[model samples]
Target chain A: MPRQRPPAIRIALCLAALAAGLLPWWNAREMAKSAFPGFEVTAPSAGESGEPAFFKKTVVNPFSPHKKSHSASLVRMEDGRMFAAWYAGSGECAPDVAVYLASTDAAGNWQAPRAIFNREKAMADLGRNVISVGNALLLADGNRLGLLFVTVAAGRWSGSSMNIAWSDDAGMTWSRAQNLTMNPLANLSALPRNPASPLAGGGWAVPVYEEFLGKFPEVLWLLPRGGGYDFAVSRVAGGVSVMQAALVPLSRTDAVCLMRDFRPAQFMSISSTADAGRTWTPPQATELPNKDSGICGARLPDGSILAAYNDRSTGKRENLRLAVSGDGGKTWKRVATLEEEPGFEFSYPSMVCDPDGTVRMLYSARQTQIVYVEFNTAWLKEQEVLQ
Target chain B: MSTLTVFLLVVWFFQRVLPVRGLLGLGVSTAAGAAFVFIPWLGFWIKSLAPNASIPMVGLLLAAILGRACNKSVFRPADWKAAWIFGAAASLMLYPSALGLGAFDTYSLGWPWLFHSVSIALFAGVGVASAVLLWLGNRFGYLLLLAGLGYLAGFQESTNFWDYVLDPLFGAVSLVALIAMAWRSRNPRPANPRGTTAP
Candidate 1:
């Protein structure tokens, strides 16, 4: 008879094999309960006069024009307090870049910018040598706040990964950062741009993008876990020419994603999902012009889709405008021009509609500071009338 | 990065980058751990190589190197050939679609609840493969078990099961090894010397 292995080794290998098979299946079962049953637009009651009630634009971080500031995101807490976050440093890919957070008082006064995350903090949290930080995205889950930002350890932005940290008592304190494993290849190239939409069950439908060998839009489904949350990445649409998806929830089981186009002279790419985020239609070009810049979209109180992006057709990011879509995101009309300097840059606009029917917008102004804007439906209507 | 992954990176630095090769398995591992704690630049260099590696792949390489150094090796030449074949096959199936070469992405199957049919099939395949490998007492069976356990334990940041099993580095090395093996088989050396005939 052939020599056989020891019975104990055989039994141990069998047990390990059983464990290897059973564990991922158990995790899969647990993850199956995390449903992305689409998102719902939760706008406040809408009845306002067209007399332009409140319209204000202010810089969130002023003075320090030498330092670069870009990609600001906004979130309104359950107590009606608003917070804004953006990354600022020497330059775009400089190692000194850090994510800054600023909160507004009840009276709408913006606080000074504070560095919440940086390269050293990322190195400590991730046990890796981070090269830089970019694109701070803030989302509010009831009272607690979640901030998802980008960290680059090697290569360029394509070599970045998304790290998330939560603050229970607003933006004062935060949990240690946890990296979201997005890619199988080196876990590279997952970046966040716009704010997240609240899912039906108890999660956030965050729109992130991949930038490794190709640029594509992906939706990060975040389900609440103990202090932080468990996350899964779902591709919104796969292509090499579109990224930075801004999600606008149309119904409880439907949503539309608007993405930035990397192809030159191309319009904004749009895709729709009917069965939550399980599947999406092929992305197609929209009517709005995109010069490879970040854009944000939100469903307005009056059942209109509002998208903010650089209005230039084929050139620089000098002009930024807000366009409203009546029939979903099929067609758009430019209602207001937020920034229109010929040579200066005013791009990467992030917008959110507050609970009290107030519309807030934030964008990078001249790459020097983040400009904050607040308005009402009445003011938006007035702009439409003027147009 | 996991603690084990950090330790493995340091071990990799010592095994592949350093000039010292006369140490035992335990000695190398201990010195690598000490260097990681006492030295900062060494940690930075090791972590800088992270974007090209995965935890399980690092563990596998370290295990083989340590087994050889300890003189209690678990893998034979045939076992390494099996590992190379598995790595090469997995890389060929995953990389092209994952890098966006096709309409359907193979990487999406790694995520849960997104592709129901594909995920189910993949799970069943893994279960069956695990059973067969364990039945035959293959050393790669242990590697698969460790990868599965590490993925389930959430040892690393990656949620993908494939990230715990294979990376581009392992795939590339396996492909190169397979090609070399094929070339060697095709062009074998003669047993007799140039001026003498076989007795």
Candidate 2:
């Protein structure tokens, strides 16, 4: 027979195991508290134009001959100019698909879209034949701008990998593309669908999701380390399938993420990270409806949250609605209907608030054109009243 | 023919020139590899049905073919156990995180220092374990060393350490072998009575 340990030793070993189990929980809790020490909710003022009322709409890629142009992301440069990026090609996931960029001048005139990167160039640079390219995301890291996109190598979504290029002089000229060494196999298929949320520390929290084999979301925090940036990934807890997270910074350290539900629910999933995106609570469903399409969220100047999403839970991709949340994304009131046609597919909205309190939203009107919309809080309030 | 098919055909021709007992085995294995690569009917069907083939898998199949041509086991029982262990461990780490079932994202560790350290430690541990097994008259150590060399030489299309070690094919094979072993252990054959075994 095997000899039994002493009662005292067994008790000590059990205690050690219990402590080890509780260590992560305690660390996460402490980190959350330290990150968001005094979290509070501030409501937006009623029917006040914090800035001049401006409402402008235009077609970003009006003359592109490509069969499809979608997945647009908008970024505001330091010089008050706005640049929008989207992938255009023969169709979705085509080998010829490339990331294109266009910018708005000071007079609000949209420039012609130019192909910045494509599969041919990327394949030559990486020394591997890239199957396709999609999911073009523009991130602003201080004076420097970064372009993040996905390259499918094995002609399948599961074989996708992330590639990035940086432009120091805004979106004029970009550096050579480099593959993100996230895995040895580089089989981690992730695509960024939203702009980077500025973290309290010297970094940005960019929302990315894995689309192959698994459909879920994770936050890539690009922290400034050594002389450049190093990425740290934080997995969002809960939810069987979620993707394309749009992050909204509630406070300096606290933030909420809105994700598109890929499961059968067709409802937008929400998760909150209080420790500057180090850890997050499990995602739960929001009251807002989603049609398994991309959504965009931005923090307004008046401390209001602006969200653009498809209004219907299940149907054709129609009725793109814009809503404002005063209480940190807990609840939202529909302010304006961006698109309400029954047959038209209008989705993948990306928004950025300008210094003049103008909210610029760029979305795909159909698969053919990129639609741009600029509105102010006063315009949103008037639309709310009309609704 | 596709590049994969051409490569396998060349391997088959080379093996056929050698003095081997089962030339048909080489032809059969080459036919299977060719079927998977050039035969669109079967290749597309398998890709659509399973869709998790990686570069490492092709390497393993090629190794098996070469081993057969040389009249030796590429992966002995212990080597199969090692592959099984690797496959099962990778499946547990990757599938759950891929499915969004956990908080700790194993994929995140792919690029960090933690991943490099873990990879190195795993390599060392497998080396030590293989050495012990070899001292006890097991050939798994040699196969493990071969795998380590293959990884170091960057044989797989993917640069991920996990990719070189395991994929869905190995995982499924490991699971099946484990189950079969358990079943056999549960119903062990009766010992021969006083050395009177059947010829």
Q: lDDT of all the models against the reference?
A: 0.77, 0.67
RMSD values for the candidates in order, in angstroms, are 3.9, 8.7
Model 2: per-residue Cα lDDT over A74-116, one tens digit each: 8877666778899999987898899999987888688888888
- What's the TM-score of candidate 1 when only chain A is evaluated? 0.92
The top-ranked prediction according to TM-score is 1
> Candidate 2 has which clashing residue pairs, if any?
A184-B159, A184-B160, A185-B159, A185-B160
The global Cα lDDT (0 to 1) of model 1 is 0.77
Interface RMSD of each: 3.0, 12.9
Residue ranges of candidate 1 with Cα displaced over 4 Å? A1-19, A43-54, A355-357, B1-38, B48-59, B70-73, B101-108, B111-117, B188-199
Question: Which stretches in model 2 have alpha-carbon errors above 4 Å?
Answer: A1-50, A106-108, A154-159, A169-173, A181-188, A237-240, A313-315, B1-80, B110-173, B176-199
Error of 2 at B77 (Å): 4.3
What is model 1's interface RMSD? Answer: 3.0
